[model samples]
Target chain A: MDEQTALGLIGDRLAAAGDDCAVVDGQVITTDMLHERTDFPAGTTRYTAGWRAVGASLSDVAAMGATATAAVAVYAAPEFDGTELGAFLDGATAVCDAVGAEYVGGDLDGHDEFTVATTALGETDDPVRRSGAEPGDALCVTGSLGRTAAAIRLFDRGDIEAANELFRFTPRVAAGRALSPYASAMLDSSDGLARSVHQLVGASDCGAALTGPLPIDERVDEVAEDDADRRELGVFFGEDFELVCAIPEAELGPARDVTHCRLHRVGTVTESGVTHDGDPLPDRGYSH
Target chain B: MDEQTALGLIGDRLAAAGDDCAVVDGQVITTDMLHERTDFPAGTTRYTAGWRAVGASLSDVAAMGATATAAVAVYAAPEFDGTELGAFLDGATAVCDAVGAEYVGGDLDGHDEFTVATTALGETDDPVRRSGAEPGDALCVTGSLGRTAAAIRLFDRGDIEAANELFRFTPRVAAGRALSPYASAMLDSSDGLARSVHQLVGASDCGAALTGPLPIDERVDEVAEDDADRRELGVFFGEDFELVCAIPEAELGPARDVTHCRLHRVGTVTESGVTHDGDPLPDRGYSH
Candidate 1:
């Protein structure tokens, strides 16, 4: 079965399962796994792999507006080069440091291929959830999109340096925290803007009218073929790691001021179904 | 690098990494990953694999004298049969219910082979640690040992029923919690009794002189050829999922009363090295 089907089988066994992070008594817990062959390209370094793996889970915690605290990992491989493993640890530590979390110890095991499962712990008194959005709430997003899609294209074309630079991401922990008090609903867009909006609407039992322009990263213009490609990449490509939130229009100025990151007004929450440019936005995005 | 060396590289990143579970702010967190090739033999069922995987992490939490709260998983496979995935989820849920922990969501992805990583969260007010053992403390263990080793042999010999029965285990959550207030140090023997003692000593800055007979399970006598085979299996075979602890000699009776499990008085903590039968015990056990 696919992930979505498997998840359906799991069905409400855990109330925290659908949220970005499972908050238990104020502790925010999130986990993400990365497989070498699927998650990394041939040119991807072990350091970058480690960094990206840890960052992915931390981003989930950020989506809950939690303060990153500590993380543990399960690292599996057939055998690791000492230098490479060290570099991987260094990369993990660097990302944790960037988000004000500690890279705690993890388990190591032997496997035929490389895999990493990282779990991050965080804390928050007032956490955000995607189920709280109401009709008339403004749809907003933090930072830009399409950089990761652009990076993948570069990697495919053998532009390893540029790809590496673009692939590395900063988890929006600080900005998520800053927007928590005002956000009606929030989540991170690891599954592209289109999919993320669909998930948000599903959770909140509401809809969105995405009438504004896509938040296209300048990097997309440099790497993509044309305006159509840029728009498609911005809307459909995943791994953005940016917070998408529903908030009252009045809170927009404070969110921008507190986050110190450009807050784009993407749309407005409606009674039902998501639309962009007067057409239905598809509910598909990257999986696995 | 192998698992041990990679762990050595991790070295002192967190005070609790060396312990069975890391306790942060009264919350206990632990993770374990199982690869298909290394963890399961041919003919193993998907249900057993899932149960074993989730049980492994819960075992770590139990070793810390924590009450398991919830668990999350990272399941990866090249492709999954719908029936097999359902069975796996059933197994995972069964184990979680057995331990009174919620099977809260997980991440699923495609990979070259089947692998599972489980993380369990728990809570404890007075969690046990491996660094608290002191010289003159009594070294003790819960339940019998050598079952996993015996099970491996059974599987090798094509006795699948017997092997499955022997391989399944119950995490000592209640017993661990009962013993928490008294244990000087504690850890689970997932790496065999001998290696576990050595690790406890290494962490506590002391040694143990193992002077008693090995706690060989009754199944070992039924499965093994001789006394030497029993001893070797008990000491060398791992994945026992039993807790080992050090407590003051005077408190042994109270610990036994509290845990309600067979409290085996295997030895005493010393200034340095382990010995059995008046000879040095080898510092050898399962790795990876």
Candidate 2:
């Protein structure tokens, strides 16, 4: 999707995963547990762009298969620094509204470096677990991968067209929703492909393969001609809000409009664990 | 109102007004907004104690007539350099359970200092809002105050007794719940008694007169008696999670046994504005 769509969808009424609030039914739901839960994804930098920092967390709630409601944004807005607290608020409010959430209430503080803590709560459910896939399931991805990684490089190099096309991502909510009902296991591919495959194997007792070159952007191929370097596509970067679903091969649907993006039948669900050809794998997955 | 009582309530559950996870109906809730919504009583001190820093935000939610559900805590845990994540989690979790909330989920990061953020959510017909007070209502307070300030001074003097009584505080959930039915206005005294009264009056279009001193611990009185200048019951110094509620004088009987702390009849709500003796006013009662 385009930038506006992505921003709008994630900004206002988030169903859930990450962020300050996820809306549920007629009431608002949120939390305040983000201050000290730091044992995972260590070293993730906290940006000083106040609301954007908040958007970062709320987005995580959305990725987790839930709906964010209200939020308590405790941001350290430094004093006398004309750093546009207004812009930060606008961006944050935009993200909240895009996701269909509300800014219920919050507090502010003054500090040396900018630090933001958000607590978001979502509607109730036994959260769709990461360990529910079975053998004989087909491995599928919601959208293309290589694009985001490619965009990172392009953006850094000032390739604005390609960067905008690949970096401007809209969360796969519809696809995630559609596949969620049919898939045995699911995950969000914030980390790259090889790592995600390893995660699925660890949780569901399976391995995946590369039946074809990854769904690379046409722009990427045009630039890296005959390079045969798919490493960038498989295991290099992060920040792709796509879905990885495990479904039975027999129940998989025929070709449809979702074809705008490619979905590859990459591998098999095995009891013996991860393998490509006859060899066992080495890495467990992505580090972050 | 006692030190251990507040600590026992959050017993291992860091649900103090500024802990890691706020306990709500037996669940822990936190979010990124916690970084933005929390405040430190004194200005610019490196947070050396993780539990105390975490308690500030979690307790704020508990005061808002809600409970903790799940939390996403983020921190730079320099304090846990060689310690197991379990002890840290234990301290954070104990506070979560103290308020009847639990830690369901979160994210983690590292840094130079020990910093934490907690986000909590709870339930109600609607929150017992501060904008509900009316003229001629009873100005009531739950629990004691001036102890935290005393505790801070004790921390400076290496006096464990005052420190013990001061830092450990319980959110007035039971009192908030009990008073919810009859409260015309509600607020938590996080800033200070005078500030809290002014806030309640400002929000509700009425004024309040705190005719009597807040109930300070006997040890605090002993310490204050030694320093004539420090004898003010409640003016400056933060971290008191007592509830400041406005209720009709006629309806106090039905609230028996429901309050978790001592309910003090401090004064009355006024139609014109709040005042102390002939003083017109100074601070909005308190400011950072």
True contacts kept of each: 0.67, 0.11
Predict model 2's lDDT versus the native. Answer: 0.51
Residue lDDT tens for model 2, B84-200 = 344445455556556665543333444333446555555554455667788888888777767666776666577654465456555555566677788778777766777778777
lDDT of 1 by residue, A88-124 (tens): 8878888999999888768888877788999998999
Top-TM-score structure, candidate number: 1
TM-score of decoy 2 = 0.75
Off by over 4 Å in 1: B13-16
Measured over the true interface residues after superposition, the C-alpha RMSD of each candidate is 2.0, 13.0
Interface root-mean-square deviation of model 1 in angstroms is 2.0
Isolated chain A TM-score, each model: 0.96, 0.64
